[model samples]
Target: MTTAATDTKATGATGREPWGARAGRLLRAVLSWPNAAALAVAAFVAAPLYWMAATSLKPPEEIGTHPPTAWPENATWANYRDAFTDNHFGTYLLNSVLVSVIATLLVLSLSAFAGYALARLPLRGKAPIMVSLLMISLFPTIALAAPLFLLMRDMGWLNSYQGLILVYTALNVPFAIWILRNFFQSIPKEMEEVAWVDGASPLRTVLSVILPQATPGVFTAAIFTFTACWTEFLIALTLNTADRYRTMPVGLALFGSQFTVPYGTIFAAATVSVLPIALLVLIFRRAVVSGLTAGAVKG
Candidate 1:
């Protein structure tokens, strides 16, 4: 065996790591506090999703163990079948889709025009308008609950799809406008001027030139708006008392009877509920990243 000193000298001469240093490097990497913290946070965020999926796979008998097994012993799709067939998952899913899509579209259309005006037009008191909108967005939804309900009730709009769609659109527009305005501002003015010189109208330029370049921002806003509408609980609950008009969040809440909660069924429903949101995010992940990172270089 090589002596320690000989090994060190040999490694130094050959410009190679000694076995001990290699071990130490491995140990350091494994024990790094920052890495450990990052992994811990990642696990914390991902664990519930994993648990839900795993639980959804497990049969009724295999669930509710005090010392839970990480992997299911008997994986089955029965729970999912029950969740779909026995529950009103189809209706809830349909309601959520309509609400999320319509709300997102309305926000995008209205915010695009508003953002373009704020970014490119010579409007008076724009700063105050922006600040006011920001402040309004910051207001707690709980605070507005009573007032909104009273207003909706007065207008005979409670428990209706139109009401929920309108509320989600209005609620999300301010933030969408802010995002799109920033995106519009980040784009150079030379392009728009070029469009103008080519005999394009302002509307034509907005439609054909600037909006295409601002796709990332539009995608980001859609994700945010859609996610909010998809997962909204309190407003959906408060506004819609009828079971038929209930959204997924409310539907998820009514997963069990008083006698025995169907944990497996609940998990199954939860997994299905999360799938659409996950798919949406996955499909647009690149745009979301680009949109979020766009202004960082300039700032």
Candidate 2:
């Protein structure tokens, strides 16, 4: 047989591997050790979220079924209605958004300034100060909760939005400052030199020049600070004792009473609570990854 004819016959009429062979190869690659491990990890992480969503849709009676169902047999929106109307979740959601946004803004503003100063300024005790910030950030939140409650009460700020905002900013600032400081240090110094040569003031240079390059770092800090503020239960519970001032986490906890627990409503509220942070992280995911890795190796 001619070489061309033999080649086509050995392969297929198309002169390529047959579809069955390609399918087999693809399956083998998917079931490879690395890909299988990744799938396992993803499923592990996603299992709780899937369960929460499924539970949120389940009917009240089905929530405690003996030998629980993998998927809800009878899904209903009653839980969502209960979450929004019966539980006054809308108010709590609004409070959460208000506190989280304001806290994130304040954190970003303060951290940027502090980070810039630490990264670029010629100052005394910089190392000690950075170390102190790390230590403060690592300090347990439980330890500070009582003291902060007392401080807020003394200032007549308890049960007020400003109380939570201030506390959130303070608790999250040190870590944010650390992230931004590393990112700022990673930025090329020559850029700042050029800005200075052009007679841009320090604040002006940061706003116009350095900040544009540090967008990822800003987003990273914003997401982290916002997530922290959004989910913090201990401080929110301690400070905002008034029902009107309660945030999402505290509100979700109140969905159950001492006599009976409303699993469906609690699950629905939790699902809603996760949405904002999940959306925020999804949108800023690239920036977060870049910001985290960029600071690892200084330019």
Candidate 3:
């Protein structure tokens, strides 16, 4: 017998794993504590979303039954129809889209320059600047609400798209800079040097060479900034209470009257509001993951 076969025989091992052993290994992996915890967390997070969808589909009468139905007994699309037709959902959606897209663009444009500077420039106090940015990002939104509202009012920007757009850009810029800076750091500096030697302007170099390689980071920042602008409630409510300027979250809260809350319609509106962000994350999940992991290692 060959040395490999002799060794295998000596160890009483087959070249292939036994079916029973393979099955047992798989079972253990499936039943691992980490897997169980992950499943539990996923279930916990998904339960409310599932309930919202189910409740939105339930008939009005079935919604208020003493014992709640896990699934809608009498499914209907009436709630969705009412949410769109009876409420200002379309307007709210448009407002959200406008604010989010504008804010995301401004944030990316500004942060791209700032991030590149922080990552590549030989500036003084870069560490302190970065730390300050991180601290600013973590600062409470509620704390800034009063000051920003007053500023907007003084500037006559309240109830205008620019008001929320500016605020969202300012609020998200710090975090975006942080993400993009880290990602930029992960890029090779030699590329920029080569571009410089080839007579490329700094702006041209960034636009053509650096930015392309940093697409993952840009997309990640865009998604985060857009999501924040989309879902933010307090700032939108405080700064823009006008019917035309209200965002989806604010609009959703205004769905029903004080005495009779329309659960199904509210759920329907909520579900609709969630779809854009969900789709965004789903579409760019890979890029987001890559961006987040880009600066985790260094040679």
Winning candidate number (TM-score): 2
Clashing pairs in 2: none
The sequence of per-residue lDDT tens digits that candidate 1 reaches over residues 71-166 is 899899999888888988789889999989999999999999999999889999999989988997898888877887898899999989999999
TM-score of each: 0.86, 0.92, 0.88
lDDT of 3 by residue, 66-175 (tens): 88999988899999999888997889999999999999999999999999999999999999999999999999999999999999999999999999999999999999
Worst 10 residues of 1 by lDDT: 290-299
Question: lDDT tens string, model 2, 1-299?
Answer: 69988778768987788888789999999899999999999999999999999999999899889999989999899999999998899999999999999999999999999999999999999999999999999999899999999999999999999999999999999999999999999888999999999999999999999899999999998998999999999999999999999999998888878899999999899999999988988888999999989767652
Which segments of model 1 are wrong by more than 4 Å? 1-40, 295-299
Better of 2 and 3 by TM-score: 2
- What does candidate 3 score on TM? 0.88
lDDT of each: 0.90, 0.93, 0.92
Better of 2 and 3 by lDDT: 2
Cα error, residue 179 of model 1, in Å, equals 0.5
